[model samples]
Target: MGEKQGMKGYKLAIGLAIGAALLLPSAAGAAAAKPSYELEWEGGGQSSGTVIARGGVSYIAAKAIASEAGLAISWDVSKQRAQFDGWNKSFAVRVNSDRGVLDGKNTEIGGKPFVLNGELYLPVRFIVKALDGDNVKWNARTQTVTASGLGGYHARSETHNGLTFTVVTATGELYVTGESGESRKLADLGDTIYGAVKFAFYDSPGGLLHLTVTRNYGEPMIQYRVYTAVLKNGELIREAEAGYFRRFVDNATNGGGQLIVTDGRTLELVDDVTGRVAESYDLVKLGGEEDDYFVEGVGPEYLLIRPNDRGLLMLIDRKTGGKTLLYKELLDKLNQEYAETNDVPYFGDWLRFVRRDGDTLYFRNDAPIQQDNKLYAYKLPE
Candidate 1:
């Protein structure tokens, strides 16, 4: 029961330490034209290199990748090997050999490394996979490789009850790593999963973690499903029915064993332990049906909501049952900033609620292409 931070669209802060290698099969006939590949870091930075095709496999200069990816590289002229060291892991590749040593274990890099113009060149897929195991993608059309630096998925680290844990939203495989560096696979969420939000209930005996995963399907995304699961002490305790909303909105709990939920029409205070509704509210009757209401955060005396497509936020008085419009000016400013650059009207989805820490609330303008990706903060009104 303190102010819980909302983690909806926050990026995970991970470096080379957390990423591991996974071999990616090269596309057959990819090197017919001897195409070059471009490596792009999601946040910023870019590097490009000429691709060397060997038996239909693509390799790129290792020096260019190591510099851009922040990897420490050491070359051994006598041994004809290049060693890459990150914060916590190291791997070595030898020229004219497909065999490599990853963290002291011999592994197949899938393609051979070679010296071209006195520079060591390694397989593009092998270099990316080994550094960041599952967080990379190869685009054949553009001949580009996008490295998200997020381990190929969204992750969040949190500390509770003096113990730290990291939850990874690796699509189809949700994993949690404890303070002792032990990882436990919580569930296989399926392939359509795009993102997830987790809540750690530490008051329970062994702690209960609730994960709400979102999935989308169809060419135009005609359908959406939100899966809910609860895990206790690394064991899955509950895998319930589909969630009520198209988007899994934020929830608030008070350890009094009650949680807040909504289906964009009615709001319910449900028991956290037992799947029972304690109280329900007809939101449309209080306001109107024009807005697709979703819970953003819950405070002691009020609930925050984004009336979808309205370009404003509403604060509902939980005790007095009154309503107040807040943060319209902030939204307009963000929209103007986006409009000036995007050359199109600002869509409501571009603005997202990041989190609420104490009396401060945070928001981010998630413009797909923008120079500034900074978080905006607004102090709550007293």
Candidate 2:
């Protein structure tokens, strides 16, 4: 394979001098030269391990090989056998044995296996070539190795129709692949990604994908930013200038969801077109012993609220100023069970469960012994 130019790593010109190196005597001598290759993972992350020259062959660290190639490898110390699996192929070998088998074919590695510092080492060039039978290239001159055509570290995956969306956690890059074997990078989100990045798909006028990226600093007082991006014109574009949200909008729609910014007292429902507050809901004083309350979401008729220490979920009618307690039994049951606060959703909202509109809501018990996963129908107040 040709080397990608302007790539800080990999020199495609020197192709490992494989033929010439294989001609050397198989017995490695104390005087023979052993060198380390700089390992660079696709899109980032770099590490290097020494490649031992033994019996005229090159042996590499097993863990290093598995990581760089994204292979799942396990060594059976008792049997002296190591099994390697990746890229739809499997290979097996025994330490100190060159007569290995890959995909039922007899194979010989670059050198006799060696062990260094309690880690098993195997033939370097042979294992790399085994990944799809020759998609990787090594350079003896630069001592750099490159593996091409392998999928990225598949951190998360979602399938719609025949297209699969995968996220590479090492880098926040997104990729979409279809059944036709055609694949493309959906978003080049860079290398400095932190925490879980969520994607919401919408098949509106045209197909659109929304990405919500969050980075948690793990402190209660310091503010954090939540960025929303949309796939527009085949590009991932940020919706608005990323602003820190006091109250984040839980986009609970199948295709399109509205954004609401709040200052604890006044909730501003923003118009996506005007980028201004189209309407506002000020927190009204419903006379009671209010310890702490949160504005959950505003519907066409009522606003959802859960105030106090008991996890009492209530809905306040915006027009009538009447409050209806929707879910009190389950929340109280769960809170009393755990001796902690538990929250549940009321009826007439899509976000009652799993960010998908559903009539059923689930309340999970956190006790280690019980391990209860309670499901309840979103019940309307009588």
Candidate 3:
């Protein structure tokens, strides 16, 4: 009986030891895993490099690097060769099966080298074109980049009402549609037309379409001011004076049936029936200082405004002067995460709140917000 009891105790101890040994490896593995990229702004340019052991990648913008070795080159670890490309050129490169680098080159500009995180990364335009084809174009005026021959893909450049517009298309019919029930052949713009159209209020409610027409007065002193025009039945009529307006940030119809314009520091709440200002106030004054306050979006019930340097968001009621905070704690959390002192990129600023469905606010950002190479989703508290 004593021997049997001793054998049972030994077996139980062995089982416990085995279970702990199995858990130790898993715990170590979980602790070792981390994000694959790190983003840092060094000088001015931006570049990204892969991390080997930790699997952390680093990305720096184009303006951060000093000089390049003929378009920075990185070793293709998967294929075991050197690769290169252009900075800010919309292209990608990878190693071929034959141990050769495959890439499309942009024939327009020469390549430059960029260093990031102690490693060199070349622009994709040089490498892709060198290995693949020479069908790539970049339009700086419109801020667009394009490549063809790999199934032919194009992306249009879009922005708030501005002087510049850019788009990229390859061998396909370009279509232009307007809210004013106007359709025009985009090819008619020009042979080198490479961007999207910039109008004052295509995406905004009660917004007008403004077009820039350049005429040669044959005099060196030619002055032009930005003008607003209402588009109806494909015709521009009812012109309004927009004083040195840079661009339309956000415009919407309020609950009181008025159009609110968030133009820089001035917030003009216009009467819906008449295109006249009903009530207007300087947002800078409300914020207690001359801060860079811009209206982000205007919902049916609320107006979202971002005050510069405050890092705190404010919501104004359309009906009353009552103000509420939308996830102030989240903004604080983001600031703490970045360890920023004055200004940090607010996820709310990047995102456009579209609709309030149930208890959630649906929003989308114009550009991809990335910390390292990995993506992050913004979460607001209830």
Candidate 4:
């Protein structure tokens, strides 16, 4: 009886030891697992990648970002650095360092890059900004980071007088949607590149619709031809003319005057009713070149000139013959917004003129580097 009782006790102890061995590995595995994040693109597709935590900051694999952004990447093991080249630019990052080289200039990154299990990890936002990626956002609740590749596909719309004009870039179709929520096709602007078309309501005796279309070819050099068209009463009155550059200048009737270039160095403002040159401005004498600059908007007192390389706007005062740099203030405001929204300062690449309403001028940064593209209204200097 004693022997049987001892045997039963030994068997019970062995069973308890086996149970503990099983539980030990499971507890260790649970502790080792870290949280992962999802990466979503503009195309509505998503992939999962490992998000590592270091010193309270989040880092993602650099290779993963390069893959999504279509960048070519290579590692220099001796230098402890990685090079990413794309979008006509190159960026290099080194491990254990916060300094990076973008396009051959030194720039500061958000955090030092690190390696984990043979994969290079970097701050995702820093890489995105350096590569001129589209807007990136992090959703902590969803554990997801959404981003768009450089030159992501998008549709655009403009509103004027309670009507919205929408351009579908993929199909090169233009549609006008009225206040009644009804939409109809207006024109077929065949095979134009993205952001190659602009529309404005011309104030004239008949209030015509003005359109500028740019056709581009020859990549890397980027040669383009500009075309202009006019529509009266939803019918195409004037077809697109080649190489004709013109804009409607604001006038007293809340209408616009046709501003055109008469000679290489002379800009003429023509009266819309009579179609005659009312006034002319000599661009060369005004310290501007006709080829390097284009008229963005003309006010009662000044004309806004934008550079061809998408630099700052130059304000030319008609009365005083004074030139004032206009976009520094606008760029300051944009940087503030960028710091708030993108957690980084704005990089000035392109300043786009949105429109003008009375004494207020609206502007936005268009390409290469941009924030959410919020229109900022700057009251014209009186």
Candidate 5:
């Protein structure tokens, strides 16, 4: 797939700062002012986010806040609502509305959620406190929102085929070795490797490793690159022949944008496929990564591993490298509903987060929603 699209063999572009402004109506009856925020993670990793202020309050990007706390977010366009979930709590707030339902309780955030330049901005401290109580530390001096007391990653396991890959990071190199003890170095990543590189089997061929990454630690668009590890005698011998990568901006910007692969140029990965319809609108940012999964273009924090198959859903905390389980809740709920309605015996069938269209997240499940009937769909969050 990467080779045909010219993503394979593409070189990384020079790290560039991309900024463009599209003014939005202000809550204070004036134009919203954009603010650049510096995010300091627990592990000394940092990234910048664009913030918008309303009525003297700093409305941090909801995605930025969610990423810090290892949460999932979505947008519902039809109802003009923004949704967020973490641990076991969920919240849904409608745009231009003062009240929202948080964990089944009516909580008042006072201000409404709004969009600016294709990003969703909301009351940051309020949302952070709502989902992750007492876990956030707001520093007025450094202007950084620090998140502490988070959970740890689940135990790492072997692949279905029984291959275990390990990555050892250094100042400028990554040492990758298999359980068989054949190790190799990946230095093309750069002189300094800032993110954790992740790898999995290619699925098509044996002994082929698929490497995913997010590099440069720069920008709103996180480029996910894919590399094929050529193996001889069960040991990786060289880099990908030509690394293919994909560029993903915050879903808020192009909620309905085509899922495409690009190098120096952009190309569509899906053609003639429609995005799931959303009820309300919520701006969502692609969850950023730090010390979490890297490679195949440094990847994001939130991902549906094996979505169509086992549908094991999880979110990773970049700092602690922890993985939180979420798929079981949805799967158990939906599967029970299906069995009750159809009068069938319990089957180990499952649901999955299959794809995304703009601000909408699509799932492959038997939810009694969406007339399409193939996938269970939900709006931004609520």
Candidate 6:
């Protein structure tokens, strides 16, 4: 009996030791799960947008955003829906779906979708807006779609069945294959006769294409322009011209045969054929300096703008200019993490910057204080 008891005690000790060993890794893992200090922010604000949390990070839609404090994020600014990240995840998904439908990769989402560049692509507008008195609609007869939202935002476009559809955004341009078996600009009407004139989707008139003549701005100004055209029987035709605009950011569709243009501080609705500004809005006073903006047209009556700062997101009314704070205190923790990673001070009057592969924002430091070049990856609130 004594021997058996001694043996049982020894087994108990061994079991306890084993249990402790198993728990050690779990404790260490819990400690590691704590957010890293690199994700903190110093300041942030939202005009009238909502903050959305996904995968432990927070993001704000561009339209209704005012400013953010954690990290400075930049987009390609030339491509319609392209963000700072080079992956173009949205486009990739769309293209992949397209190819899957065409090539039979995997029939999952709706059906066997199509693919492009090994990435899926979808037809949804890369930039959408949510605001009061905003309307979006699609017209099948004219093959046109339109949007009208806050700040008089509007857009419209006609598409060809078997052609390539292309749209430019801040980050990069994207092309979608049309049913016409040829690649065409998604927003372009067709090829124009006059090589000098270029066209773009202006407003909801559903009229001819517009034209814009490019001017030389010398060395200081990098000319950024958008043109739309129409093509028939492989022949290009010139329809209209929208004059060169500054701070061109993104594009959106309005239901009434109009197109909306965002120039960072304002939104412009243009008439498709006449290349005229139907309406405009000054939104600079609505938000903070670091706010991010995005615009999208939903149906025929609403445009949505989502802004986020410090993990707070809000949706604003574009027409009424009313604001709403969606999420709060969600990003404060992440802001702290970002503060810990950046120790260097921001100097120099102007920082020449560029984005690489669409994900990383890089700046050439001309300041006398710093000699080493610096690169910053776009960071979101954790």
Candidate 1: tens digits of C-alpha lDDT, residues 299-323: 6656666554443456676777677
lDDT of 3 by residue, 236-258 (tens): 33332222121123333253455
Which candidate, 3 or 5, would have the higher TM-score against the true structure? 3
lDDT of 4: 0.60
Give Cα-based local distance difference scores for all models.
0.57, 0.52, 0.41, 0.60, 0.42, 0.34
Which regions of candidate 1 are displaced past 4 Å? 1-60, 63-99, 102-105, 108-174, 178-257, 261-277, 280-286, 294-306, 311-382
- Candidate with the greatest lDDT versus the true structure: 4
Assess the local accuracy of residue 347 in candidate 3 as a C-alpha lDDT between 0 and 100. 29
User: Where is the poorest 10-residue window by lDDT in model 3?
Assistant: 213-222
Candidate 2 C-alpha lDDT tens digits along 1-382: 2345634234332444564466565534423544665544455555566667667566677776576655677778685888876433577888778778887788876566666678888766676666543345567754545444333233556676566666666666667777875668766555644545555554334344544444333344223344344544335433422323222334332212344444334445544443444666654364143333445555555566554234445567767768765444344554444433322321111113322134333434333434446554454333
TM-score of each: 0.37, 0.38, 0.32, 0.35, 0.28, 0.24
Q: Which is better, 2 or 3, measured by TM-score?
A: 2
Which runs of model 2 end up more than 4 angstroms from their true locations? Answer: 1-46, 50-55, 68-155, 160-162, 169-171, 184-191, 197-251, 254-295, 302-382
Could you give me the TM-score of model 6 versus the true structure? 0.24
Compose the digit string of candidate 4's lDDT tens values, residues 1-382: 9999999999999999999999999889877666465555544456567677677667888876676555678878685989986534578999999999988899988889998888889886676677565567767655556565543233456777666776665566667677885777766666534434555555465365555545444433244444444545544444332332232221111214563433224556655544445688875566454444456667778776644433346678888878866555666665534433542122223456678888887878653345667886778667
Rank candidates, lDDT, best first: 4, 1, 2, 5, 3, 6
As a whole number from 0 to 100, the lDDT of residue 280 in candidate 3 is: 71
Positional deviation of residue 329's Cα in model 3 after best superposition, in angstroms: 4.3
